[model samples]
Target chain A: MTENEINHIFQTWLKQHKALLFKIVRSYAFNEEDRDDLFQEIAIQVWRSVTSFKQQSAVTTWLYRVALNTAIKWTAKERKHQDRHESIDVSQHIIESHQPPDDRLAWLYEEIAQLNEVDRSLTLLLLDGFSYKEMSKILGISESNVGVKINRIKKHLTTKSEKS
Target chain B: MEFKEMKKIWDTQNDEALYVINEDALHRRIKAKKMGTKSRTSFSEVLLIASNLCAGGVVIISHLLKNSGNVAALTMGAMMMFVGVYILFLRWQRIKRDQQTDVSILGDLENAIENINYRIKLSQSMIWFCLIVIALTMFTVLNSDQSVFNIVLISAFFIVGFIMSRWEHKRFNLGKKKQLLDLKEKLINEFEM
Candidate 1:
């Protein structure tokens, strides 16, 4: 595809599906700097995916695959860099600027921030209402495994909500 | 709150925009990122290939200019040119392989790990490459009919170069290579109970 064509499709997808990206960012990265970093990384990955997307899956699935993969790798890499960290790059200014958040949503994100990387991905999928089959395919786990994970995560979130 | 209520709150974010994006900035950054990623990933290979090719070119040009009979320089020059071609071929193959889009997150994670492993290996090989270059230089210098003082100076120069390369290689592996391994470990062990 030509550059303009890729840009058009990317903009369309971004306009249509940015809420999903933001949720993943919030769940994966807690601080503003981390959020911006994750956002930029995901955006770049998504843009790169635009060319390779053959539409075998929904655009949302493709975006999630690319974005989640980037976020997971990035989160791990950031842990290594966190100790000898420099200030945020000027790329920090690219995508995300947060507004005041809803208290309940903020609480939910706080809870998500406490989960492990794999569980965090499962939570995003489950809360986004992806089916067990879809989650299994996306995560490369068996459907039964997806079911078991979702049940455990739901229970944990429930217990935490009640205690709070 | 029930799971149903929690689901409802999550669903509320479906149409709600939690974060504002700057589209103009995003466009600019994405273009720059595409360009940056290309250069950043291939910069080392470019440097290696270009330097080797330059070494080969200089050797050939010197022989032509001086009409000298230097068998060692000619052989080393051919070897450097061969190494440059070999690196180019390997890079082309990798680029071909990386173009395919994997179908799942697990596949993506595996690809990322593989790419990092390649980088780690490349960094390790680079230190070795430096040593080989220094050894070759020393061989050439030793074969030359230079004054004893000139031979000493040349040997000292190569020795210092080798030491500096060793330090740089260690520093690179410690920072970037260690983090890459950590990320790979995290990805592979992500599902562990």
Candidate 2:
């Protein structure tokens, strides 16, 4: 795609689906500074992802893959640099201005943040209504494997929710 | 509060106007990000390669300008050129491999592991390069009329440089590689069972 075409698609995707992208960022990063750094990285990836947009999968799926992969790498890189102190761009929240208004949603994210990186991704996909087949495809695992993990996640979350 | 209820809460974000996109600010951010994400190693490698080629060129030209070419100088200069070309080729291959897009997260993770392995290999090659160059120069110095103190000082300097390079390798590459490997194992275990 041409540069103008890519720019247009990026803006359009951001306008339509910033919430989706922001969910991955929030799920992956915890610290305020780290969140901003990750947001910038994800936004950049989304912009660049425009060129490689094959129509085989939905745009949202492609975006999720790109954002989650970036988040994983960023998380690994950030953990390695424990003493990092670079200033971040926080002029505007870009995607969303305020925190989730609902206490329950906030609580859910906390529980998600407790899980390992891969399961955190599975939680997002499962919560967002992706099918087992889609999850398997996105994760490069078997549908049976996805089924098993989903059951486990649901069971674990239900037990935790009851305790809470 | 259950998983189903959590899904309902999450789906609310679908209609939530919690996001506001400022086109100009986003344009600026994207532009900035485009420039910033190139790996620092890539930049340093380019500088090191240039320095090697230039250093090699200077040594070759200076030695050749004399009545007779110094065999040791010619060998050292050619080795530098060879090392530079070797690094360039490795970097080019790596960049090419990195450009291949894999839509699956597992595939991407695998690619990341491979990239880190390549970095570790590159770092090891550099250490080897330093050792070889030092040995070549040391052999030349020993053959010539060099005093014992001067030889000891040069050997000490080379030893210090070697020690520092190993320290950097441990500090930067090995730890990160282990973390990624652990993450991969965790991910695999989560679903494989």
Candidate 3:
């Protein structure tokens, strides 16, 4: 595709999926700066991949795949770096957000944050209403495995919710 | 709760609360991207200018020495050696600066790759400059009767320099490939874990 066409497509995708990108970054990043960095990285990656986007999948699916992949990688690097030092103070920005909290949703997010990178992705996909098959395609996992993992994750979340 | 109930809550939640991405913010990002591109292009231009100046200076010096006769042979040889050493020093400094700036994993990899490609080109030009200076100095110092031996020696030196240059090119490519692969593996492991 031409540069202009790619830019148009990216602009449209960005406008439509801005909230999805924000949520993914918020879920995966440790702080506001990290979230913004991940967001830009995802945007650049998406722009790079725009030419190769065959119509085989929906644009939303492609966006989720790219965003989740970038977030996962970034979070892994941050975790490795964090091991050597005190973690950056991400909680301050989280507290300063003006949105009123939903206790249950906040609890759910806290639980999700505890998951390993891959499990976190699966849970996010499940929460977003993607089917096991769709999750497998996005994640490059077997459909059966997606089902099994989702079941395990849901049970784990249920136990955590009950305790809370 | 059932999956459907969770979906209902998720769907109803206000996405606008998550982010307020408007045209103004996107416009700012676009401006940043353009500025970044401009900076990179200008940096490459600077490198191109330096490389041309180095090559041009060497060629002019070589021509002047060749036209000045046998007495000028020693002076030309000394000048060529000095120029070669100076070029090598400049090349070393450039490589050191590039290494320091390009080591971070946070920056865009494609930009890094492009910068490395430019450096490789510069290195190739430097190698050619060295070879040309050495050859011209040899030609100036040797008598007309020694033409056959000088040709043989110059040919051998040229071959050796060419081989070394090719090896350096390969090393450059291998380093870039390894970096890109490491990046890919890191990303895949993070998402596939």
The TM-score leader among the candidates is 1
Off by over 4 Å in 1: A78-100, B27-36, B64-66, B142-168, B173-177, B187-190
> Given candidate 3, what's the lDDT at residue B121?
65
User: By lDDT, who's the top model here?
Assistant: 2
lDDT by residue for model 3 over A43-68, one digit each (tens)?
A: 77777668767777888788888788
Per-residue lDDT for B110-191 in model 1, tens only? 6655665666677677667667766777788877788899988987887887787677666654566576666556644655
Please, what is the TM-score per model? 0.83, 0.80, 0.55
Give the B-chain TM-score of model 2. 0.77
DockQ per model, Cα: 0.59, 0.58, 0.14
C-alpha lDDT values of all predictions: 0.77, 0.79, 0.62
- Candidate 3 lDDT, B14-93, residue by residue in tens: 45364554445445554455444344423543554565456556655765766744544444445545555665665566
What is the lDDT for B99 in model 2? 76
Give the per-residue Cα lDDT of candidate 3 at B49.
53
Residue-wise C-alpha lDDT for candidate 2, range A1-164, written one tens digit per residue: 68889888987888778888878887998765566667777888788778778789998888888888788777766465442333335576554456446788778889899988888889999998899988888888899999988898899888888898
Model 1 pairs whose backbones collide: none
True contacts kept of 2: 0.72
Candidates ranked by DockQ = 1, 2, 3
Taking the tens digit of each residue's C-alpha lDDT, what string does model 1 give over A89-130? 465455555566679877988898899888899899888878
